[model samples]
Target: MGADSGFDMVPRLSQGNQDRREWERFLEGVKQYYADDEQVEVGPRVIQFKAGEWPSLPMEGHKFLRFSSKITGATAAKTGVENYIREVQELAKAVFGGRIRPWNELFDVWGFYRWDFVHATMKLHNLVGTPLESPAVWLVLPSRKDIATPEPIPLTSVNNQGNTDLYEVMAIPGRGKGLVAKVDIPKGTQIICEKPLFTLRSSAPPSMHHLVAEKLKLLPNDKQREFLSLHNNFPGQYAFAGIMRTNALPCGPGSSVGGIYSTICLINHSCIPNAHNNWNEEAQHETIHATRNILAGEEILISYANEPSQARQRKLRESFGFQCSCELCSQPLQAIQASDKRRADIEQLDETIGNPVAMMSSPQKSLAACHDLIHVLDQEYGGTVIALLARLYYDAFQICVAHGDQARASVFAERSYMSRVECEGEDSPVTQKVKGLMRDPTKHPSFSAYSTRWRSTRTARPRNVDANSFDKWLWKLSG
Candidate 1:
């Protein structure tokens, strides 16, 4: 059968691909600005500006002379937000050689100008700010009309799943500001869904300081105070960068974009975190969900690394200018040693399970290795490892379907869907695909790849089997 044999239930564009397409569209939209006489870099440009210095126009003309007074260091600092808009208007003329037009006027233009990138693309609006010495260009992706946008649970809706009122911000000892549950939060409950205060490019230029400063200035006075209140480990000249480094969260699958959130950034780090953070592309927000039941008064924590041992986690924490004394890090020396060994074994099993040669020659052994890795992760990290668990279960589901074990594939696919819904949102493409597989495992692309060996109906659960016995049977565990 062909790869497209299934009902095509899954969304075609992955988050990574969507981002790339948006960037390409942005490049195409801005291509007209590049002069035929002068060679300009094709992609995003990183230009550096000195403190209180305005960006030099890429396209120069006599029209720029009018803005000379406003662009100077002494006058730029004295200008208020109102004057800043006029400055941007003048700068836009200079940058585009009077060819710059409103976004609606630009026929192919799509995407909102994120506040942080307003300085780079001088489209004047209420949220606009002055240009930085080295303005960083940000390409915002146009919203996909084909995919249904997932609505987040309203903050005030009491009956909604994962109500926002369940948690509160408080000062915890040792850890500065941390989120705490006011009441018990069950697994998969959404804790927070907040749009970022600003989204910055990871490869930002040195003039990012000025860009950040300009963005902050554009905020209301109250928001400006709130932003300044966040933790800043880097205390010297570039205070803005310091605060950003301490609080920025990854915005997507790739590291190209980093976002700052006032509330989510307050959640502290733990080697064994009870909560997990996810970037919801559909909602365009950073979401936090309880990976396990979190008791009242318990501090919310999320892991900072993928698979950092205790020692490595400690080292990673030092960059935040503090040492972690979480449950995992506070264990006895012998316990820590045992935990490290378990983590090492989990890594080894992961590698073995992914080996193509092992899968072809010893499929059973490969499946068993995945089971072992899941067990180790559960024992060590508990529900905090739900993301990894979801991936592993999906792998097992694929293996079972490929070898024609519809019964096992159905169970694994159900598990994968539940775990993915808990980790990613229920609307996620992975979760939706797994849901379809649970309904009809034979529809999987790899279902006919190998001859039927352990074929059975999708509903082949043993009657009267206890929960423990069912799990053992599902995993093919020996007595």
Candidate 2:
């Protein structure tokens, strides 16, 4: 082959390009191969390029290759274009020494974009690629500069390390034993990162007794004692399964698996909790963050239930074998009625904010829904509730991103990152993802979903305004 030939121009080593110079030299060599069909475009936060056939892609058929860092679309290997897809995949492997999948495998197989976590959902639903509400409900949200000067949020780790000085575990009046703060704990402080003594795979209740027994046998003598010491709601029946059922916490939100943490499990439940317990995937441990200031000698409580007061009471009784008499549950008749109304509104808004189809078809409306959810949350809790707000802000980020709005997306990501840190600390994988989004919202796989009508660059953010102006810009509210 001639020196100008594409095959000889680039080194095809398995280790891939060793440096930028090598990759650039290789790109120059192969320019002739894709000269006819290729296009390259560089943006403020991302680069996009279309290239020739993939010679060795795993999928059948040939396909055109669009390599991008910010956007993803449903791409399947077509009869003639599979070669391009193969070459792109192999070339990426050759350059980065890893697989580079810009599209979801399931989406590629299904020939549509109905699957995937629906971008930013907390309720976890497979809302189809069709709109749940009228498409015209999508109000055009205005983006104006009305934001306060941005402040930095520092990430901290949960380094409690089983230290007892932060809080002491002791008997409570009627709620058995719980943790009490020995010193004033500030809001957003992650006071504990406790590793689970053992984790249980999703299984049937009949087998849990055997499973728990086997796991208990494997623990150290003291850990085994600690496991046995945990409160068991089931008295006459089986001991191991009852404790496992009553004390085990889900490894993470929406996770079917459960883990038993000796200390975290000991902290009793409250409907109005001062601390938030979250499982950090990156840290492989559970963390408890103070959602609001707690005075010394006060109880450090985390919500074991996340349903409405009535619904949560039912859940708590059925699952954990307890009747909740927390502040919200024991409120005066008029106040209890009001709290339930606000909480029910929150659930509805929460589901609406997570509707992917609604978000894509009417992003402005979804953005407005996010605002409404936060408003209700502020009323119900009176201040920032890190756990709930983190998911909502992330949903807002994805809503902006689906329509190609980067300036607002970045702000939402920043807020989401702060919430993640405050709820799960900096070591969480979710926090890191949000941090990356703050710099380049396009890094999200869902960017430019189906429209770029609201497209704007990161630098397109409005300046010389207070935080309110930024808010108006973000929500597309007019001054």
Candidate 3:
């Protein structure tokens, strides 16, 4: 679970004294990098990569840096084919993380300084302005002429980073950029699953711009550009700090460590969002699920972290540099007050339910509070927040299992398992663990932790009981 203290493996870009030629300094650095290699091909532009397809297509060359390769070389001829072009596409992906960009260029522009990939052609123009800004390996690629390329696909929402068929990441007039649903997305559908572009440890220093730069420096040329393209609210401060503060999500619950995702960061915030995001520990990636039926063209928004309007406003403004006029925040004054009261009640119940003293001294009272909390939540959110519901049911399950009440525990655990599946999916470790508990409540680690006074078999849950009778039996309510 522990990460490196810092990015110590990535090399620092060093400055030279006014004693040697800049070109000589560059060559010396390149030699030092390849010193350990057995074969040193000090030759022309080499497009070296394992090609996937047969029947190579004619590739004249691609322009990189300031060089234009006109004469054909041995290395260039070896790699100047259709398959090598695919390798370039794969390489360009390191920069922007999109498998298929709108321009439809497939160029290996990752390590290149100022490399451009457009229309199946490669050119170096913007980004890192100077070669010194890039690592020593950036100077190693062979020079080649850009040949006439095929037409590229136009820019559209369909050209998203991942299998984002249901939604599109694009420019929003007021919000800078946001994800909008391309289709009517059903509730509980998994929209996105992505690994972090950059995951900073909890031990990061107060001023982490330098470390951010170092991390970017170590990555391929294209990846750096992709990450830097994300919105940065603080113009006056370090870009990484601003972007990280603005877009990074936590690695997990209570994990101070934050991760920046290529597509996830494009999702704008709302106090009452239509989508819910979660980090799965077993998968080592993040996922976003539609909390409700999201209509086509509607912006797919996620709660930065839903809280009281006052807290939400302060955090959004301070951290994200935007005043939230979300549905919950924009509600009329009376309704807003009512909603806040409901939220406050939910928080209070959650705190009390989590208290050991409240569970021990007044177990039945805590169960009643749990029941009341669910009803209040039904009024406020109408079960759209399945993760919250999952947790609430999980708490009730533990309470039953702790007191050795397997029948109610089985029922409660089943609810938790179902709710968890709606959000985290059945494959999720948390969901699977809940499944185990539902099948056999005694398997819960906290089973019989408090007392076994209410012991019963899991089959004690009545099969043919009426709904009204089942409710009384489940909560132990005397009729």
Best by lDDT: 2
Per residue, candidate 3 scores C-alpha lDDT tens digits across 411-443 of 998988888787777787778888988898887
Q: After superposition, how far is residue 30 of candidate 2 from its true place, in Å?
A: 49
Instruction: Mark the regions of model 2 whose C-alpha exceeds 4 Å error after superposition.
Output: 1-161
- Supply the TM-score for candidate 3: 0.65
Q: How would you encode candidate 1's per-residue C-alpha lDDT over 198-302 as one tens digit per residue?
A: 876543334656778888888777666666777776677878766766667766543345677767877777778887777776677888888999999898788
- The local distance difference test score of model 2 is 0.61
Q: Is candidate 2 or candidate 3 better by lDDT?
A: 2
TM-score: which is higher, 1 or 3?
A: 3
Better of 1 and 2 by lDDT: 2
> Relative to the true structure, how large is the alpha-carbon lDDT of every model?
0.59, 0.61, 0.59
What's the C-alpha lDDT at position 67 in model 3?
A: 23
Candidates in order, TM-scores: namely 0.63, 0.67, 0.65
Model 2 residue 422 distance off true place after TM-score fit, in angstroms: 0.8
Cα displacement (Å) at residue 65, model 1: 49
Off by over 4 Å in 1: 1-164, 204-207, 235-237, 306-311, 450-457, 460-464
